[model samples]
Target chain A: MMESDINWNSIYEILTGPALWFTFIFFVGGLLIRLAFLFRLSRKKDRVIYNHFSLAWGLRSIFQWMIPWASASMRQQPVFSIVAFIFHLSLLAVPLFLSAHIVLWEEAFGVRLWSMPDGLSDGLTLIFIAAALFLIARRRIRPEVRILTSAWDYALLGITMLPFITGFLAYHQWGPYEVLLILHILFSQILLILIPTTKLGHMVLFFLTRAFIGFEMGGRRGARSW
Target chain B: MTSPTKKKFEFENNTDAPVDVDRVRAILNANDGARIRTWLSICSRCGLCAESCFVYVANDRDPRLSPAYKFSHTLGEMYRRKGKVDRAFLEKCYQIAWLQCTMCKRCSMYCPFGIDVATMIAVARSVCHSQGITPKQLAFFSDHCDKTGNHMGIPVEELVDTCEWMVEEVEDDYEGVTIPIDQPDAKYMYTVNPREPVYYPQDISYAAIIFAAAKESWTMPTFGWDCTNLPMFAGNRTLAGKQVKNVYDKAQELKAQHILITECGHAYRSMAFEGPYMAGYPDGKPPVKIKHYVQLLHEYLRDGRIQIDSDKKIKEPITYQDPCNVSRNGGLWEQARKIIPYIAEDFRDMAPNREHNHCCGGGGGIMPMGPDYKPYRMASGKLKADQIKATGAKFVITPCHNCFDQINDLSEEYDLGVKALSFKEIIVEAMIVPDHLKLECEK
Candidate 1:
């Protein structure tokens, strides 16, 4: 090989090797997971046509209908609602588009979507970590919601943010390199498995329910879709 | 009256009391797990509902008084311990679920999230029903209703005798009006709360006067004649089911098209909703059609079946108290308001009216339970008094038995100098004469 063959990029080694193995496991594991989800769904009773369509649309609609900063409706104060709301929205925006997720996606399927720039990713990551921390603090603090909440629920939430935090650290190459990377992968794997099991399943289903509820209200009920 | 054979009139000790802890545990465990989503999923905990609740407003806004919290106290514990909760814990659950709250849906209307507090209470009551741990007061009245076939415990013979007496009284006054029972092929089967046959038998005459003026084919069945379903308040679904089933059986036996429940809150709720669901669509057949008497009369007046001779000649201003069960739960608040002016001339509007109107503190078997529940009753009824005072009405016209009981108590206890009047009482004052219409000739 010529001197030019010595590609000085450590990223080359990551892209060609370790990232590849991590991603192959993710794909096979993710497919197995989604297959189990399909099996579970198949056993449930048939959904009405509206449900099917709304749910399909609702799956992709978290960012589709962006409102101008969620103005407060007369009967509903969407302010506190917006707090948990942003915490969720940040979860979608930050981790799903982090540089690591892009790398994993490319390795898994040889497909690529735009990843956020490093500065934007870090800024959003910090904001998201802060928002999630705020939510955890609320569940620990607010008496009413606190009564309904359990420590297991808080632990589950804490476990969920671990992957994002660690992956962000991995991207920054902060702290012990191998340990943070392993923690990131382990937490991400746990989140992927736990997604459909808990009330956190509402994280996926609430969109569909909310959208359908909105459409039902707007189309037939004549109430404004909030 | 078939002489009201003594065999037909004895009260059974349905208590099965000295309750079996094991059986009670199994039933509680089963019911607590059955309707999980109805209790847990429906509540979104937006505190807007706090303002409309009688218990919350009356109890210094302790979160416990919030109907939502009452549910959490009971159902939450049942969930926490995974339904292996103790009988002692359940006894308290029974008290709060049955006594502390009136199963009113006023809060549901205010709930921006549409968390139905009444549905929660009803489900909680369904649990209590399984436990046989209902309030002693509700239990007593329900036992009396089940055994004697009427909450007032009027013997079957005495009930028939009173009906016959009303027939005689109506004849002497209107000339040829007949109050027939078990009349085959009648279009409507009318029932009143046992309140009439026992004490205010005059109200029966008022009803008779209305029916006769309209010349409708109606009947009252003496076999299973009472209409008010008491087991509903007691949270005794078995008895409620039997009572409602008996109504359908009697109606079917008489070949009646529709049976009308009296102006009793629990009665209408049980017969109109619970009964149908309990014995609904047997073998996929259509459920029996039942209507509340208030709504039935509202339609009667609305469609010109009955005409008022005068806006009841009373001079005092009257404010209407909407029974929470009837107005909010039954969706008949407007219909109730529509019928009031037909019976009584002077009706002044009250504040926080319609579906938002306060409970009259008598429902959930509170009144018949007597005074043990009076403290909770007085505490919860302050909003009602405030609304009444705002109306400055001399009389409060409520078209429900429980509301009537509560309103009477509040009026006397508060010394508001206001009289509590039922629609029957007010309509009796305003009903036109059949003799004047030349409609009767039996004398």
Candidate 2:
């Protein structure tokens, strides 16, 4: 279909209406089900004596791991840690601080937070793209990482990077603005939908994994997980 | 590189035949739980866990031995197939789970997602146990523990006789020192690994001497004296539970306030942590408090209950090997570190001591897997051997029996030239027995 002939309003409605709500429902409902399933599994009833500083130690470990220099993994893989830190930081910052995203929040919830400048947003988007590419390259170049790299692992990376790439293109108006904008929204929706079921679930589940490990190892076992 | 001893445990000769595929599926299904499901789901296959594994590192970073690969090939495959895997595949899972990995849980520390790889391997082991595919030696020991209340099958008469012999042996060192047997309502019910009586009876003497010096009210029970639970290693949870129950019942019968475990890692972990759960006790709490010997020694040192002669320290440089169960899994690392300085003239720390220390490769029942797996176990301990060698210490003091045995093997195999001694041995050596307390030999 010709770009001009495309019904932009209808497309925006579909993307923001059914697609957005469907992905949100699936993402939330699927995560809840998975969590409930996990809880239903047989748990051995054991009263473990936790250390007095377990909570503090667990929180310390979580924060320590979030910093590249503070983690043991950083000593072994400094390059990966640096790139991953940037990628994770930008992953949260770029999307949350985008002017368009803030506007959407203002429209939907009547609350608006600070938004990043266009130039800063553009710079972060580029860094995010570069970080994703570096991760994919590392997986390919490193023999150890390469062997564990399944097709789905690559697919998850591609899916994660799509929204940023499309947003960049749409923001720069490199291609037809209407088409790129729709593509960005579509990719974002797809990502939201797939997250709960795929490795992307790590975004949400990482907290539980870290907290559980911290409590079990640091608190109960008196050992540091980090 | 199979040793001649390992040939005796030939898979073809095993009497407990492999179960059908359906049975394997059922076992896997039974083990399904939140922990397994979450771990299986969240691991991003980032390969960060690879560096933390000794086997993977010792094997020249072989992808096949990586913790991720081990999980994928065994538990991951089981999850994928929903337990409908064929016999050949099940057998492969048995080797990967039992022989390849030691279930040390070190990798979990490095994992950003904190996947409990060791527990998943335990689940895989449980599956193998259901199929009767465990190592023959492990099964034999578990059966021995079931029948004779010890891993080595030493009868009650021999156990009592051995305690009496140890008491007489220690009498030469200190006067008025006695090894009480079956003393009820004591403050501590002291238990030990069967290996003490079978192989190293002197270790028992050392513990007795330390207890006597501390003037602690401890007694050894004749019934459930074997604190080491082999079934916990063999993946027989039911039998593991029974063993824990036996010990609990014995302690309750003796009316001891505390169950004092010797310098054994797995025994302490299984009893103090896994025991209550295995015994089906409410909230998985044991009937009484459980304390490792290291904790007791630490308390004694802190409270001036036992006096260590700081001037009589060993001149040779000594290092400490953190036992996986006691240090990492049990959280008893600092206690041993605190006690080492008082006993040794010069103490060295391993590069990655404490929770991050590498496994001795003899854990998860690998030590009891016998001669057939000895070469494999020794080879996998290359990292541990290198860690010890780097310390350049004359002696390595480990508070756990398994680490001591494994470090001893690593020292011999790698020619590290380090003697592996228990914490009690070092403590006894540095302890000052007053002239008034020392017994003069009768001419």
For model 1 chain A, give the 10-residue run with minimal summed lDDT.
Answer: A216-225
What does candidate 1's lDDT look like per residue over B249-334, in tens digits?
88888888988776677776667655654554333221557777777778878987766677446677888888866766566777
The TM-scores of chain A alone, one per candidate, are 0.67, 0.89
Worst 10 residues of 2 chain A by lDDT: A44-53
lDDT of 1 at A127: 77
Model 2 Cα lDDT, one tens digit per residue, B1-443 = 12224333444225544457777777776666566677788788888888989988887787788788889889898889887766567678777887778888899898888888998898788777777777778888888888877889998889889888988887766787778999999999999999999899988988888888888899999888888888988888888999888889999999999999999999998998788877887665789899999999999988888788878888899899998999899999999888887788789899797999889898888888776787878878999899888889999998778788888888889899999888888788888785545877631
Docking class of 1: incorrect
Query: Considering summed lDDT, which 10 consecutive residues are worst modelled in model 2 chain B?
Result: B1-10
**lDDT tens string, model 1, A144-164?**
455555577678778878977
Q: Looking at candidate 2, what is the lDDT of residue B208?
A: 85
lDDT of 2 by residue, A95-188 (tens): 8889989998788668988999989999999999999999999889877788888999999899899999999999889998888899999998
lDDT scores of the candidates, listed in order? 0.64, 0.83
Cα deviation in Å at residue B236, candidate 1? 2.5
DockQ scores of all models, one per candidate: 0.10, 0.54
DockQ-derived CAPRI band for the predicted complex in model 2:
medium
